[model samples]
Target: MSKLVGSLQGYIWRGYLMAGKNTNKLLSGQATISSKSYAYSAKEIYYSTLPYAATYHKSAVTGYDPTKTKPETSYGAISRSVISNYQPSMTKAQIQTVIAFEQAKKSVPDFRIVDVPYQASDGTEMVPVVQVFSAPYRDLDDYDHDGKWTTEATVRNVLLAQENGSGKIFESNPEAQQVELVGPQYAFPDDDAAMLSSNYYGIDNTTRIIKRVGQFVMLSSRLKSGIFYAKASDLITLNTNKPTVIDGIPYVTSMPLAPASPNHYVDTASGKALKAAGYTKVRTLFDDSMNEYRLKNGVWTDSLFASFETKIFSPDFDYRHVYFNVSDTDEGKIKSNKVITLNEGNNDFKKLLMAPTETLLGK
Candidate 1:
C-alpha cells in the first residue's frame, strides 16, 4: 500500500488516503477507523484553514404585525474580505539563521533562552541545552546588499539608491527581528493542545507530529500552539537529536489520552494524564466556551453532546472560579471545560461516549 495524501494537511499517510483524516481527527478526535498498516507522521505539525465564505444574515423584525404579514428575512452573499491572519511557518533556512543568532545570544539584548534535548548513542538522553535569540535585524544604511536576510539583502540597494551618499539608519536587525519569537519546546504530550486540535480552533486533530516512514520530515502543525513546521535542513541539529512523533501520522491518538490513575494528573505527562484513574472514557471541558471532547486509545474524540454538571468551590481551598463538573450520573452533562468531578452512579458520567449509544455500530 502507498501513502495517501492528506487533503486537509497535504501530507501523505500510509493508510487510506483520507482527505479529512486529520481534520476529522481534529473535528472529532481519533481516526474514524484503526489502521494496521504503516502511517506517516511529521516533524512540523500543520493546520489547514479553508476559508468558509458563505451567506450571512442581517437581522430584521421577526414579530408578526397585525396590519401586515411578517416580512421574510433577507439573505445575501458575504463579500470576500482579506483575512490577514496568514503567518506562514518559518522556513528551514530562516530557522537555522535564527538558531544560529541565538546560539550567540550575548550580542542580543533582552532575549529569551530556550532549552531543548539531545540523545546519546547509548539511548541515554542528554541534558536539555539552552540557546538565546533575538529578532532578525536589518541595516537600512545599505538597503540592497542582496543577502538572504531581507533587511540585509537590500542594504546595498538602499545605499546605491541614495544620493550624496545619504543613508538614514545604521542598523536594521534590531527593528527587523524585534518581533517576539518563542523557542521550540521539548515535544511532550499536551492535553490542552489536543483539545484545540479539533474544530473551533479547527487546528485539526492532525496537529501532533508523526513522521512519515523513513523521511527526514516529521509531521507537525502550525495550529498546535507555538509550534510550526520547518524542513529538517532548517532545524538546528544536535548529536542524537531529531524531532519525534507518535505514529506514522501525527493524529489525535498520539496526544496521550489513555488509562489513567486517580488524581494522577501527577507525574503523568500530558494526554496520558486523565482525571479519573484507569478510566477508558471521561468528560473534559474545553476553554471558557463549554466545548467538550472525548478520549480513548490515546486519541481524542469530538463528542459535542455531553452531560452538564453543577460545581461549587473547593471546601478546603480559596476557590474563585465556578466549576461545572460531571455528576456520578452519566445521563446529566456530557461535556465541560475541565474535569469537574465524576460520579459512578447509574449515570456513570465516565462511560459517556460522544456518539449516541444507538449511533455506535458495535458496542
Candidate 2:
C-alpha cells in the first residue's frame, strides 16, 4: 500500500523500485494466466466475464496431476499453482521504460540524494517501522522469515520513504536517530486461501479478537464466541456519556472488494454494467467503508454483495455460508457490507486480514 519515492537515492530507492516492479510483474502474470486458462472453453471464457464466475466454471477448467494418487483438482487450485510458479518476464515496453529510468538514475548526483523524514499523525517523528532481525541480501547470513530477502535497513528505509499511516515530512530538517523496531509478521497462505475460497471443507482456520484495555494489550476478556480486530489507539477513549461504557465493534465490516486470488479474473461484463449504471468497481480495499446495494426489479438488492462468498463449488454450496453484505447503493457500502464477521466459526473472516500469498508482502 506504500508508494515508492522514485527521486530518492541509496538502498531504499532500489528496494522500492524492485518491489514495485515485482508487484507489477505479479499482477500482469496473474492477468495473463487468468486470460489464457479461462480460454479452455467457450463456456468458461463467457463465464469468466460473469460475476463470481470462479464458482461457475471452476470444474470445467480444472485439470489433474496424474502422478498423484488423489489428484487434487480444481481450477482455483491448479491456476493459482501455475501463477505462483511464474517468473518475472518484462515486456519490451517495460524493459525500455526500465532502461530509461536506470539511465536517469545514473545522471543524478550523489549530493542531490533525497531523504524524506516520516512523521506520525500527531506531527511526531517517533514512528515505528517493522524490521525483522536480518542482514542485507548480499550478506546472506540472515533472511527475513517473511521471505522478502530485504535487510532490516532496507525495510526501515523503504517504509520511512513511503507515506503510509502518517505522511512523510518534506519541508523541514529532522535529526536521524534509531527507532525501536518490531519483530516479523508471519504469513499464513493456506489460511488466506481458505478464507478467500469460502469453501473450507477440509481446512481449519480461526481468527483472534485483539483488544487493548488500558495499559494491557490482550484478547478480549468477555467475547468468547466472536473475533474482533482493533488498534490500541482507537480504543483509548471510551465515551462514558453513551448508555454503555463500551461499544461493540460490528460483527461484519466491508471494504472495497480487492480480489486477492491469483485465479481471480476480471468480470468485465459486470464491471461494464456497473460503470454504465454510474457505479465503478474499485480495486483498493477499505476505500469505501459502507455497504453497496443494487436496484433490481424495483427493489433494492444485496445479491451481488452476497454472491462473493455464497457462490462456491458443489458439496459446500449448500452449507458454505459466510456473513455477507446486502446493500443497494455505493453510499457507505464498506460500512454497511459486513461480509467479514467476528465469529470464530466463520473461517472466511481471514480473507480480509490476510494478504495475497504470491507477492513480496505476503511472502
Model 1: CA > 4 A from native? 1-98, 101-110, 114-219, 227-304, 307-352, 358-363
Give per-model TM-scores.
0.19, 0.18
User: Worst ten-residue run, lDDT, model 1?
Assistant: 75-84
Candidate 2 lDDT over 116-137, as tens digits, reads 1222111212111121212113
Cα lDDT listed for each candidate: 0.24, 0.24
Model 2 alpha-carbon miss at residue 149, Å: 9.7
What tens-digit string does per-residue lDDT give for candidate 1 at 1-363?
Answer: 111123334554323223433422322232322122111123111111111112112212221111122211110000011000111122323223333443343653322111112222112221111112122334677542221100111111111222112222212332221111111111222111111111112123334334322312223343433222222322221111111221221112122333355422222243444423343343332222222334534454433433323232235321111222322221223433334332211221213322333322223
